[model samples]
Target chain A: MNSEIRRLTTTERRQEHCDVLVIGGGTAGSMAALTAAQNGADVLLVDKAHVRHSGALAMGMDGVNNAVIPGKATPEEYVREITIANDGIVDQRTLMQTARRGFGMIQRLESYGVKFERDEHDEYAVRQVHRRGSYVLPMPEGRDVKKVLYRALRLAKVRSTNRVMVVRLLKDGNRAAGVVGFDSRSGNLVTISAKAVILATGAAGRLGLPASGYLYGTYENPTNSGDGHSLAYHAGAELTGLECFQINPLIKDYNGPACAYVAGPFGAYTVNSEGNRFVDCDYWSGQMMAEVAEEVASGRGPVYLRLSHLPSDTISTIEGILHTTERPTRGTFHANRGHDYRTRDVEMHISEIGFCSGHSSSGVWVNEKAATTVPGLYAAGDLACVPHNYMIGAFVYGELAALSAIEHGRSSSIVDPDESQVEAAIDAIYPPLSNPDGLPQPQVEYKLRRFVNDYVAPPKSATKMEIALEHFERTKTEIARLGARSPHELMRCAEVSVIRDCAEMATRASLFRTESRWGLYHQRSDFPDRDNARWFCHSILRKDSAGAMEMSTRPVAPYVVPVEGFEFPTTAAGDGEPDAA
Target chain B: MPSVLSRTEVPVSIDADLCVTGCRLCVDMCPLDSLAIDPETSKAYMYVDECWYCGPCAARCPVGAVSVNMPLLLR
Candidate 1:
């Protein structure tokens, strides 16, 4: 039977051994691998795409969204801001790790030739994007961030294996032994044995279908197909606040951020069709998004990012930064549409919902040290649930996870690869290749994400969520019937299964929370009120021993910095702003 | 259903005249893994309709052979 399973797909097999294995080569995975290798651990960083361009930072970032710089902002103050922004459901200890160490991480990146904007005084040019504090630090020359990280990874001698989509973590009695995956180009089975594994595969960005009707058009890099979320859940790691989805205001059809954080300080704000500012702040809080959603659904339906009010020179400056970094196609997107920042307000709409800890509190639950609930398994980056931890936070937690993983690797010996688990993983990955005449991957994935957008996008109701669960249940069989014409398509087919799993997890967590919280993020239409006494705790989702998804709650940890006198504004402030939909 | 040849302009295009036949930089830089080397032409081309139009293919091109146009839908 084992031989038959091995022969199911006639592809090459390869094995590797490392002291620490990082399963992504993006922003956090790059840092984690560099840190581990610099600390003298044998590290192997794996990515589904080339390490030079992978994950959210594939095109490099535009700015540091949460930089806790010295003299400008204290870690405690930053923590309070995020706690309020995330609606007070955060582990301060975990957030403090990012807040306290993010500055050092930024300096570390600077050491790698990455640049950050500084004023004439040479102090970091931090801008105000949050409701209370200034945390946004611009990176005008950030387009080469990935190139710099890639160069740093090479210098550190971290062995990077690109184009391998790691599907499962090999477990030895709750300790992560290694990972099993297949090559995206060649369909080769890859098993890496390691003392510890760090999961940095980013957000479940591909869960919801984009309004453009394009399967690959996603807010985060489409490569981040909920692989980490599904892998973590399957490995019994608790995922926190899956109900707290990441919904941003983005360029309609384009599906990328209107990037108010970059332009907000430059005087760009979201406005209704009547050219009135409905929301006070452009910072991406659930409350702000709730306001945006409200105005869009109301008589003031279509909103625009009001950039026309800014001076042409100022718009040019904003364009110089925006068009060059992150999604550089923003310039082309505008140019092709005959829209100019000087003449027209860029049309804006609510983005398709996704599970991301970089923006919201939805990810594999990790402690301050970046260790998951399961030992020997660590998580960082957007997938690690350090609430609202952006790029700098990813670097901070990556460093923390690397340090902890190195220590853990030293104390533990490599466990033998679990044969049964490897066989099962191979069996799961090769089905699509064998059934080449089965349903195409794109069609199956499109339907699954469409279900995500239809039944689970937001303004959640119990009945809608139940129906979503039913569709997801049926999609499981559909996933089994998926076909792939090549190894590349096989990788996408495997990703569809991952997306389906995430959709179900999101639905289950939304149902379990039972009360409306986090503004539009987990807003329950049936239960429209915030029930702090009953639902203020963190909702955790994990796979049970019986292989069924289970949910439970963990009390919000005692605050390190006490927040007082701040009224919990459950709904959007009324200024003709509609309720959270 | 029978397949029919459909014509549509893709977001990414390679100037094969300028492209180095052996270099796969643009193909490897695509996050969606959309670009691939054509065996017949020995030049990189967009193999799938799954482009994010993110421009890494063009950005990473050493010879400036790659151009990522805005997809028609967005255009």
Candidate 2:
């Protein structure tokens, strides 16, 4: 037993203790930390990057949609919108809870000096607003939200360690005790003991070529490495909704800027590859891509825009309508708007329509109060599965996670730290740091990315997924042999571990359902129908004692909404004509 | 007729703050000898009449603070 044990006495090791340890300092993590600290708990926020630019902070247009609008909007209306958007797959109870809490979160954020944009009418003039309950708040430009949140955390005296990637949660029996991670700057192992752990890490982008295009270049922040989901699963937390992945149709190739084309104010037509217009102009009235997806799936076309030649003023007006910064120059706009022609060269065009799960919906399942099955553990942001539609819902979920964590921390009694849990965490990571093997880190990442992108991408088939699963099992074995040259490299290894774990969960969930539902990126051709009877419940994945991935199913909680006198316009339409200029 | 000699001319100038020492290679390379090194600042100062915004000075400035803006009418 003594001979089998390998420990590094020479390497630097540091330990810290806190009431709450929040991982991944993106929107959700930062907000959770801020909320927890403000409620008078000592919190430590950890992130993989030195900067806190996660997906929501980097790519979000700064729109916060909450059910706070006056007049006709109510929490019920917001819940209905989500259920309608999700095709009745969303958990209405969770959706309503999030909607009810959304406005208060925004108001709290405003109190922190995070200014939202307002209209000339002196009311918030955000793009998406529901009459009774749903309203959108604008985010400031170029990562200001992250900076503001960081400042707020600093003011609240919340401690943070950036550039440290959390590899896994340290568990004492079924309860979370702390987390084990590596410092990117020094390549040192740092462990933190905490009373409660909140996984606020943002969404996972399946490992692949960075999504780039003619109009936008490497737009999505590369940091969404899926560490939170992987850690939670490894720590024996139940994960749900891995099958539902949202894809944004408007992403441009070549890493150009993302134009707000989808947010076009009503009546816009999406054109296909043959330069022909498709999609029912009225269906999913606000979000045109839902109809666009149907058109593409039916083989009607790969869409593009077609419009009559426009004068200079008309071109500018169209650019304004599309919320594009640059005017539609003959060369730039034509190339930017034309995705159908570009997607043919998969290698050249980095941007593909609906390539990713649109939102970070698949994660550790938590109660309505954001508590996981595991005691002393909580999740928020894209990391926690709180049933709602994609991006719009994630913002509200982040706030809910933070608020729920505050409540959980306050009501719960403090327990002494478990030495065995700390020892176990230390033992698990010490091997990688001490291993002398010189392994290339990027190769591991490339292998993981290829495995997910090639095998698990949308429009999946059972045979293809099975083949991919075989490769994934092989890759999991290969990952153990991977060597890290430095601390940052060690974090990369941890990231690979997280991604592999997430892929395993995603694959198992995709396979278990045997049916295609919303965001069917991993669709199996064998069972094409939406099997509501057999697979209505959520697929849950957990890790066993031997560190093996396990899978199961759990029933989704039911909730009913009062949907009466919901006045939706029937003939209301905007100009559907594409600008030809 | 007894000819009066016709000469083609250009103009050039530079800012000291935009220039640094151990540079000014552009002053020696100008074919028309329109540039001169300011000994105090070790930057290239140009004679406007003989200088032109030909981009050689801006390209050669290692610090990249030098710029040449030409009028649209001149082009």
Candidate 3:
């Protein structure tokens, strides 16, 4: 099937070739591009927005949550902690890579001018955020992380293109041949052929509607409309753990991160509405989330972070970090509502549900080397399946993907696909431009996400998910009729399809598991209990060879370090192969 | 059905005088693709209220033309 000697022709299209193509310019995308270029590969890094400030780190992070710095934490300790945090549903091999390589990734960032908080000894002032380990390294100056990464991208000589929104991949049989996309600025179709493609687009963060009724305001950057997640799924890659939704405790209405990790260092922890510490620890886990969900839904309604008791100086320090990085608009959001951390407590609520591995494990499945099941296509960062792999994990895996892609690009004999295949994608993007009077992408997106909140957002019931599948099924047709008036809206229209696919996967994975796990994330109201007998395996969703959504259970690979106190499915002990559920 | 002309309280404010023609850095940098240059005036403006208030448009503008405010829903 490597027969591609035909002359390619196209209209209103730009064609380019690179040894490796990194399809996003966010944290992982930039790092992957930098590594590929440093290894002396001709790389193309294209993003829907500018590389300088895009993806989840558009304004940079509040801190590195998974920094396994020496003298602070060991890789084994981190693996064990994450194994426990994920409720024992982790592929330790992939997470072990992130844990082991994260320190180097942090130093690389530091060398490029991204600073991390240090103690008097200038040792990485790692603090305890997880229940069992100290891995949260605060970067009070973390928003500049994007600037440092952008500089690294420039120094490494990666050719960067901003404002290009990729819609789909051009597959040459099983391997990814190239991409089919358009420029966001002028709405022109641009195609790129490459030996290897790495999708570093962040999570499907916009899957659920925010309670505030504002669609753009979300916990993760709204730009991460699950473009990479859906792109991989449609390209026939197995997506894992989507049932484990990325639910965060956030400041209500504003829908920004409450930033418990940032606030915890300064004596702020989550409390019930009556201002009592309901949970023993502030580290985010399914158990912690379950506590918050139960407490919030209880007579102790509207759980919050009680920071009013902190001294004024301490409160100001917390405010400084909270206001300037990782959803920096929290200051303005609180001010307009007449709330103060020194006086009134910050109201906290569970955020909109999403499919992300950054907070929880749910993404396109990749191995320890960051290779997806599809040949020549790799994934990194939150969109890849490395459980609870925070910022450092994203960077490490990004480098891994770039290194692996460079190696693959050297050996792969793939070439450009036929022009008709490229033209078909180009031809598809134009229909919305032609159908100016069709449904607005926003209206369709809003409705789809609302359906997610209603049926798929957990404390899930079988009936609700079944109804959700019905709505998602109808959304598949409604998304086709989505119209756009501008290139920007066209980008959104294209993203709507990705969001729809993620919604379907989320629903299917949620339904197939049939057991309540991850607190309110995948808690089936009807099931009400963890069924370790049959549902302990990772929920893997894939589009079958016949182009139908199929859900199966992938055996959670046996841990390198023996895990205690948690029960594994009986099937995992005897059978290593996945059981079709 | 007919569409009604509507306007929103845009969170991002760009100085038309400082927004030099061909300087669409803010327009290009907006992650949501919320900001676009007015073709006739050649100055970038927030065409939609979909701004997440992540503030990259203001950060990357070479001419310091973009000023961002938190949207009213949150602000």
| Most accurate candidate by TM-score | 1
lDDT scores of the candidates, listed in order: 0.87, 0.56, 0.83
Ranking by lDDT: 1, 3, 2
Tell me which of candidates 1 and 2 scores higher on DockQ.
1
Error of 1 at A550 (Å): 0.5
Model 1 has an lDDT value of 0.87
Ranking of candidates on DockQ, top first: 1, 3, 2
True contacts kept of each: 0.77, 0.00, 0.75
What is the per-residue lDDT of model 3 for residues A240-319, given as tens digits with 9 covering 90 to 100? 99999998888877767676888887888888877788988787777788888889899998888888999999999999
Ranked by lDDT, the better of candidates 2 and 3 is 3
Could you tell me the lDDT of residue A150 within candidate 2? 65
lDDT at position A313, candidate 2: 58
TM-score (0 to 1) for chain A, all models?
0.96, 0.80, 0.96
- List per-candidate RMSD values in Å: 5.0, 14.3, 3.6
lDDT of 2 by residue, A1-581 (tens): 12212222124666777888888776667777777887787888887753333344532243454435545266777777665555454456667767676666656667776666666876765555332233555543312455567678788888888667777687755677788776665656677777778887766654443432111112234456677777777777777777665344442332322332223332233456655655443222213444555655556655544333334455445444333211112123234444221232111112322112224246677766677778788877666776443343554555566666666656554455465665665554544555547445556666666666676666667776688778888876667667655554565566676667667666677777787666444356678776666665566677767877676665544446744332222432322211121
TM-score of chain A of 1: 0.96
lDDT of 1 by residue, A1-581 (tens): 23432543334578889999999988889999999999999999999989988989888889989998999999999999998998788878988998889888888889989999999999999998887889999888999999999998998878989899998899987799999998888778898999999999999999898888778778888889999999999998888899999999899888678878888888888789998889987788889889999999999979988889889999999999888899898888888778898989888888888999999989999888998988899999999998899899889888989999999988887877888999889877888787768887877888988989989988999999999999999998898888777889889999998998999999999999889988899899999998876776788888988999999887777678888743333432222211121
Q: Which 10 consecutive residues of model 1 chain A have the lowest summed lDDT?
A: A572-581
Better of 1 and 2 by TM-score: 1
Clash count, predicted structure 3? 0
For model 2, what is the alpha-carbon lDDT of residue A372? 78
DockQ top scorer = 1
